[model samples]
Target: MSSQARVSRQIIIQPTGEKPRKDRPMVHYKDRAELKDSVARAARTVWPGNARISVEITGHWSACTGRIFVNNRDAASFAPIVPRTAPETEAFDFGGQAS
Candidate 1:
């Protein structure tokens, strides 16, 4: 049976090359434009300087009490690469279904 549940939507930003952690979220954005602006502002402040990072725009799907995410290197870009993704994009399920 499927019921309605709040599907949180936020753009998550993190440094790449590090193990994924389920720890509390530190930075998140609800709007793609805002996210881009934030990143741009940061870039202008303290340059990435060889630091690698990734941005994940997630929401509209359930995780089933497990990890679900996607890393799109092809979607990476200097400016707003906005995967042009929609809330219905493919699910990035990294964990099995919850029993």
Candidate 2:
């Protein structure tokens, strides 16, 4: 996709717990301990038996009118989420930009 475009996205992040509220999909924590606690709580509510979650982050490429789907099942197993490096796309930034 080109650099200039307005995109509409649906980020489905099932974090091994009940689906997050539509208004607030992320759990913010100040520290690692706090994050761990939050995850534990979420696990209790979402999946108690170590069941894994499947994430589906889909959107449209406004520049090209193409569909995008970024998904990861069992995301909890991957402590840090990072796709292996590729030559074409050197960096991945999650921050949304105004178009």
Candidate 3:
């Protein structure tokens, strides 16, 4: 006999005033361990201290998607470190290089 289990996790970062970006796609993981690791990584990048962070999961045994929301009071602590926009990168030429 073999065991098969998997879960789809959707991570949403609700900032103070802005609405959650539903356009983003959810991430799938094989187990809870993998999901936890990925969530931690995301938390590090975005200051979840002041926003509403949620994780929705759907899978076998648990067909219904459950949502867990958390509010981080210390979110403002790391506001200065987070970049508002992507850094500018040098332009690239692929069509036979620039003359």
Lowest lDDT block of 10, candidate 1: 60-69
Q: How many steric overlaps does candidate 1 have?
A: 0
lDDT tens per residue, model 1, 1-53: 33333233332323335433332222223344344344433333223443443
Clashing pairs in 3: 49-72, 49-75, 50-75
Residue 97 displacement in candidate 2 (angstroms): 16
Q: Could you give candidate 3's per-residue lDDT for residues 19-98 as a string of tens digits?
A: 75343334444554455445544554554453565444434312222333356342211111112352322111111122
- Each prediction's whole-model lDDT (CA): 0.31, 0.31, 0.38
Error of 3 at 95 (Å): 44
- Residue-level lDDT of model 2, residues 1-99, one tens digit each, is 334322222222343445533332233333333333444444344444544433222232221111111232443321222235533232233222421
Order the numbered candidates by TM-score, best leading. Answer: 3, 2, 1
Model 3 TM-score on a 0 to 1 scale: 0.33
Model 1, C-alpha of 98: deviation from truth (Å): 13
TM-scores of the models, in the order given: 0.23, 0.27, 0.33
Q: Please tell me which predicted candidate would have the highest TM-score against the true structure.
A: 3
Error of 1 at 79 (Å): 13
| TM-score of decoy 1 | 0.23
